[model samples]
Target: MVELLAGLSENCVRLLDVAAAGVLLSDGRGVLRLVAASSERTRLLELFQLQRDEGPCLDCFRTGTPVLVPELAATADRWPAFCAAADGVGFRSVHAVPMRLQTTVLGTLGLFGSQVGSLDRSDLDLGQALAHVASVAVVNERAAADSATVNAQLQHALTSRVVLEQAKGVIAHVGDLTVEDAFRVMRRYARDHGRRLGEVAGDVVERRLAGRDLLEHARSVDLLPEE
Candidate 1:
């Protein structure tokens, strides 16, 4: 996701005719965590805004709207610290577009400029379009990660179930007992030994020493209730 955003930031500088560009994204909980910057100065300016917690991007995220500052000088009264920081970094103007997925605002896409002028209608529209693309990219990346985690968990469950079934069949045949009784005996032994039933069943299928001892113990302990 960072690599894609870095490329998109470069596109902003090239196509939007902006001096520099940076992308800032929140962690879905109103906290900015990721940044894709076109230059070192641009990176510092982004960090400055995050540290002070006051800037065009912050406003854009809060309202789920675009914040365009054509001339940073004119916004001194509104964002005094932000204006000063922009000047320090040699940026004269800035613009912010909301990075949103549906009605949920994720963060902001920031554009920095060396000159003091607003982006025209076409450029402004393009900027917003880029922001939309970035929003979708971030959300989809997160969704893919969550999906992988769920898949791994489901696969583990299926494998364990199969192992347990095989172990039950082995123990039932060895002990001359019903499959259900074999399972109950294994469950009791596992609980007494502070182990999982599947793990104990695995030992039985593998014919390990632990499996031999468990069978002997189960027989002595009574494999089933007497009528």
Candidate 2:
């Protein structure tokens, strides 16, 4: 994932003829972290955005829109800290595009230049298109991970329920009680023993807990449900 973003940022720099570029992603705790950069200088500059909180990437990510600084020298008053830092790093201008998918803003793609100038209309459009693709890729990756977790949980629940039902069947046959009553007996035994319902049920199905023994235990403990 880091390599993918680095490649994309580098390609953006080459395509737009910029001096450097970087990608910043939210850490999901309201802090932005630099995930990729075109150069070591660009990486340091991007990391500084978090500490200073006044860089184009910060603004672009917060507003979910593009931030263009045609001339960094002219923006000292607007972003005193960021402009000073950029100047020290040999950057004359900067442009930042938000990586967004519909209403979700994932991150920002920042471009730096050695000369003061703004991107052309076409270049701005292309930059935004690339950002949008990155946003989709990130969103899809998260969704896939979430789906796998849900599937595993569902499978576990299904397996447990199957064992419980089979245990109830055995209990009903041996105790001469309804399936509902057998389930109540099993549930009570699990609760009293501080054991998981699935574990108790598995024991009954495997004959580790004999049906007749469980039936007698349920009666002695008064666990059977009323008719």
Please report, in order, the local distance difference test score of every candidate based on alpha carbons: 0.75, 0.77
Looking at candidate 2, the ten consecutive residues that score lowest on lDDT are 149-158
Candidate 2 residues 1-227, lDDT tens each? Answer: 43356567878988886888888876445466676677668877887877878888999999998999989999889889989989999999998999865666667999899998988898888888887777666566455345454334334443555677689889989888877677667867876788777788899999898887677667777675333
Clashes of each: 0, 0
lDDT of 2 at 51: 82
Model 1 per-residue lDDT tens digits across residues 85-189: 999989998989988767766668899989999899899899999988876765654554463543343344335545765776777776677665666677778
Worst 10 residues of 1 by lDDT: 149-158
Measured by lDDT, the strongest candidate is: 2
Alpha carbon lDDT at 79, candidate 2: 88
